[model samples]
Target: MKYLLVQEDEEGVERLWGRCAGVEGLFVDPVPPPRETLTLRGCSPEGPLSEILAEPGVSFRGLGDMCVEVWDEEEPVQWWTLVDAVVVAHQPHPGDPARYDVVIGAGVRNEESFFDVPATPRFELLAGTTVAAARAGRCSSVDGLFAPRADPDPVPLELIGCEATEPLLVGTQRPRRWAGAWADLLVLDRHGAVMASCSVDLAVSEARPSVLGYGLEDITLTDGGTDRPSPAARGIWTEWYQGPPAAPNGWAPYDAQGRTAWLELTTRAWRGRASGPDRTGGAYHLDGRFVTDVPGLHCAIAEALLGPGRYFGREWNAFKDCLSGGFGVAPPFTLTWHESDVARDALADVVEDPEGQLSYFEETVQLLERCGVTVVLR
Candidate 1:
């Protein structure tokens, strides 16, 4: 999909810098937890296993290949325990060609080591084999295998398949200054509604003239600690961006993270639309049927106060900020929480937070009462 890179001026107006035909490094998997060594004692050599054992210094380096499958009653139970790397130091059991002790080296086992296995697990080798060269349409791997380990320090976002709309050599050259480099990457759908967004410091680190005018190889990302949407969430966004829902509460079917992402997009769309008298004494109706989680509560409350596709807050701290003023309402307002029983049953248990441990539903009600909000439960 094409990505439009735009910079916002002091007045908050967006200016187009360039467009990218394709982007890299936008969707990244979370760094896998480090692996430890394990010993598979008395593993019998059977069928193809004997052939694999015959190879000297046998290793399983393919993605997800170096793993011990856990089974509980003839059915596989746990399979995600992956080995980042493995080297087999095979030692045959004397006089028993059927029995073999498999010594797996460092970074080869996960939380459930061989000691935790209840049954002899099958070793899978079906994980796709690695390639020596990068796949087509993408640049070669920097470290010879896979994209360079996500830099410990923030790496610049890569914009591949880039093309300049105008002559890059003749247009006003953007200086490499932080003041001039700050920009936002706004991902918009066909109808121009923002689906996802993140701010970046856009100083170009590398570029080259290509058949498509110019290619921007590297652009610095400066929004520290901001989480990118997961690949699944992006799929939902792909459709929502093209055509938003006709009414409110369209985010009901999503998982917790996806629901949170929907709130983010809706919040952006709601900006500059809030208008009303001081909301100190106004009453709002909260449809509490969907208030099953922290994010879900925010979604319900935001829609209650302002219409659909609005934002009251994201988290506890942000909620407090919204209660102060200008989030389409002020405190000392009345909130009629319909179907409050659903939330009570859902969020009855306390969960840990930076502030303190408290049930989300309980804390929300308490916080509202403390802030001069009269809550009516029904």
Candidate 2:
């Protein structure tokens, strides 16, 4: 359950969440938000908003006639309409049990929270205080405003309103149901180009809070989130590590190190910004159209071409050069195109027969279509 603290500056988000050039709609159908909090121990948005006002330096906004809707597969999973509700707050999530972390100290990341959805929403400044986290170690930038000596404190965030698009949470961390959710706070120029964006992780389940600061008080209520998509817990964004985009070597697909690369690439290619459970093959807006299969299928095709040449002649080299991304070559750090003895070659599947390889590629492509993934070419 990551969060994006965006400063709304436009109308109908057709860019950041839209598709390449002429592509019309989003890949993942945006889920509508609920009229109320979905947390089992959830409280009204009022309590959190009011509590924020009492704390110095924290602020929140509200709306008159705004509606928030969250969706699942283009269908409404939750919807919330409200008059007097907190739009966004820096409060910690309810049902969040606190714990101790030897690494981060305590109290910086744990808290309770709520929000409302609306259009042209306006919230006057309840109070004014800028937040700054401690400049730990040799980093001496944040000292006074951060915290007291007995317990160093990090400054909380102040969420502002965007006048145009409906402001609300589209989706969140349902570890039992969704794979992962990416919440981006993007600074969009009028064209919706992501001039700057920040990803926040709101892995909002009942993960225990930090323990360094005792008497932090047990505020969060206990309740496993309801209506989970599945019974098993899924991965969180923070704990997972991703390699750089563009596979270093192009031979192996779904094996060795490149198996999970498709996820990061798929997210980058989706229409605008998509946050949901289906990170693999959902729907996509590519090449001015929508495709059903995931990007992993395309990754598989290029990988297949990088295999050892079947005939060991000039024709094989030429054929390899024609594939997209150049047969997914692995850079062996030398100035030459050759690979070292250790690299896991990506093209092992098609090394025996070029003709047979195409046949297999076609078969895989068609099979993907049957599985609801129709590969789209750019």
Candidate 3:
């Protein structure tokens, strides 16, 4: 006779079977059915063991001598029987911190059948079943892992798809003067990008009350505290400078200690070539002590002259011409700076006014000119 083998746990719940007929209304029980027991009895006229084997839906789960068959219906259709200690389900509990729970039952093909059943005991059984399955390298479905809820406050912008953009070019030009000090001005194409780009390194000694102006309307002052004002000024820089015809009068900031030391501001500028045939168009203008303060400043000015990105181009050739040579080939001369008006204070020699007091400031300017850095003092 064809046998229907059913394996039930200690809780008397049906478990799922793999690759079986999807028949409806199949019955299960913790013990063998009466029809199977009677069949077993008729098969074994002499012994109970033979009789039990005739019973359907019966199984044994232990080694020899300890194994107790509930009933024997054609030897349980297949001999070896196993009962997992744990079971798991993908369905999550309502408002439960634990993502899922352990279920105890015969594994089913479709979980929808269990929806109407009570959840408390089922969840407890699921939690235990999960632990058992984990040892065997089996996992439950990941659906319904977490309930819908608002995330905690202060989420990172990047995490929410708000990525940062690159720094944009506004407008570039020669340096200008503000309140007796020369200032390099650039109109930022986009204020948001500029605010993210500009940075300042305020050395300990250089720390003092300072203010940076944004366009003509806003100004931020720093009273030598931890907070700096570069971010805000950059924002304005990006907003005001958009396209080709950059605003004539861009933003400007002044150094409070103007005469004591020359300030070097490095910013990206625009690229443009001269219009005429003379083609000797690589020339940029600089006003005041910035050119005379450092030798690197000469290189920077030369780089600025040959358009924006042509730093090591024809301007470098002009700079090479300034070196003394014996008509054909000569060793590269090492350019060095001695004590100048800006750098006179070797030890506490802070005169504060290099333009009025030191003649070396003028000499420094001439030396920079020889190095191909043109300085127009006003």
State TM-scores per candidate.
Answer: 0.56, 0.20, 0.21
lDDT of each: 0.56, 0.25, 0.23
The sequence of per-residue lDDT tens digits that candidate 2 reaches over residues 1-378 is: 121233323573432321111100111111222233211112222222344434665433432222222223333233233323343333443344231110111112111224322222221111111110110111111111122224222112222221112212221213334232233444333344442234433222221222323312111112212211111111211112132223422222333223233333322323234333322323332121111122222333333322211110122223233321222232121111122111112222221121133322344334435444445433
Candidate number with the higher TM-score (2 or 3): 3
Question: Please, what are the lDDT tens digits per residue for candidate 1 over residues 153-261?
Answer: 4445666555444322123144233233555666766765565676655545445453344444333333221345656677667657666555777777776677877
- What are the RMSDs of all candidates, in order? 14.8, 25.5, 37.6
**Could you give the candidate ranking by TM-score, starting with the highest?**
1, 3, 2
Candidate 2 residue spans exceeding 4 A from truth: 1-243, 246-264, 269-297, 300-360, 364-378
Candidate 1 displacement at residue 232 in angstroms: 2.2
Task: Compare the candidates by lDDT and give the number of the best one.
Answer: 1
- Count of clashing residue pairs in every prediction: 0, 37, 32
Q: Which window of 10 residues has the lowest lDDT sum in candidate 1?
A: 131-140
Whole-structure CA lDDT of model 1: 0.56
Q: Please report the TM-score between candidate 1 and the true structure.
A: 0.56
